[model samples]
Target: MEKEIDFEKHLKNAIQEERKLQVSFFDLVSKFEKKISNFDFENNSILISDYFYSGNGQKNIMKSLISENKVNKENCREYSTKEGNLKYDFKGVYFFLLDNKPFYVGISKGVIGRICQHLKGKNHNTSSLAYKLGLLRYEYLNNKKHLGKRKELNFVTEVEPVKQFLQKQKIAWISIDNDEELYLFEIYCSMKFKTILNSFETH
Candidate 1:
């Protein structure tokens, strides 16, 4: 016998884990979406890295520049838009790939909340257009709005239309990080690969 393993128990655990990951991934994508849409960063022009760092920090900034600036912005969320102790406005970049075909845009907001908006919609998040398009699912349990989000949106639009860029970029890694500053820094590596992967695929 094959040790009469408890396959049923294993199956249930697997299913639970899968569901958990699904929710978590959805949450991550949802945050990225919110950042891009909320700030309209699909139009980013300047890709300045290390603007916020100093001295030795510049090294980390350079390392993070790869995937982090494909989509860059000053601010990407609002304050006092929701109801709660919410009070944090972040400035950072959203990443997109342009391997001759733009796929999707993502980000790692230096603060919080905005990314969820893009994946989820504005003035009506429970039913944003992106949701209708069958993109990302709901991320945070509660919704929020903050200052600088509108300004960030303007900054994003000033760059270039992301929808139009779809033909240029192949894929993108979008996200917004609030847990650890280092996590936000790591997204740049993901960005580097997005471009690198596209190069390999195109050839």
Candidate 2:
């Protein structure tokens, strides 16, 4: 009789704990939504097609031909404003939008640098979304069960199609410095926007 009573008490306590956690989670989500409501994402966003087009034609040609090592080296240069003087580096979450609908959300310590990777990156580690899109659209990649193994993938041909697709998309980001808040807000935004490409899975 005592053991039965103890189990009932434990179950009640567990239920209470779960309820508290759910309440806390909803409260935190509300706070995050309020904070994000003020951000001017549309005005702040950069169009991938426009940004790259602003550069010289020769530079674009060179960028296309350059090795990934050279591309990474080029990315190491500080991000700048249109005036080409002020440098801005930030840690935050970024969005990939197609036809004004968000498809993916990602967080990085260097948001612009990360965006560059998605735009021009040559491999799976750098351009994961493009790789995933390739897997979905290409029959060759679709047949390969080991496509997740980076070594088995052929990035050279697969990446260009998705890269062009990404160029048509728009990017927006907001700075969030606190690591805890950054991660939580990413989850919140991903859920709120119903981003199709985002997978909050552990590797």
Model 2 C-alpha lDDT per residue in residues 40-85, reported as the tens digit of each score = 6666565677654424343443344244222233333345655575
lDDT of 1 by residue, 83-174 (tens): 54443444443343343222333333332233334322233342222332222111222243223332342322322222232222322333
Position 28, candidate 2: lDDT:
61
lDDT of each: 0.35, 0.68
Residue pairs with backbone overlap in model 2: none
Top lDDT model: 2
Residue 61, model 2: lDDT of 32
Q: Which stretches of candidate 1 lie over 4 Å from their true place?
A: 7-13, 16-18, 21-37, 40-45, 48-60, 63-93, 96-203
Candidate 2 residue 103 C-alpha distance from true site, Å: 0.5
TM-score (all chains, Cα) for each model: 0.23, 0.64
Model 2, CA-based lDDT = 0.68
Deviation in angstroms for 179 in model 1?
A: 13
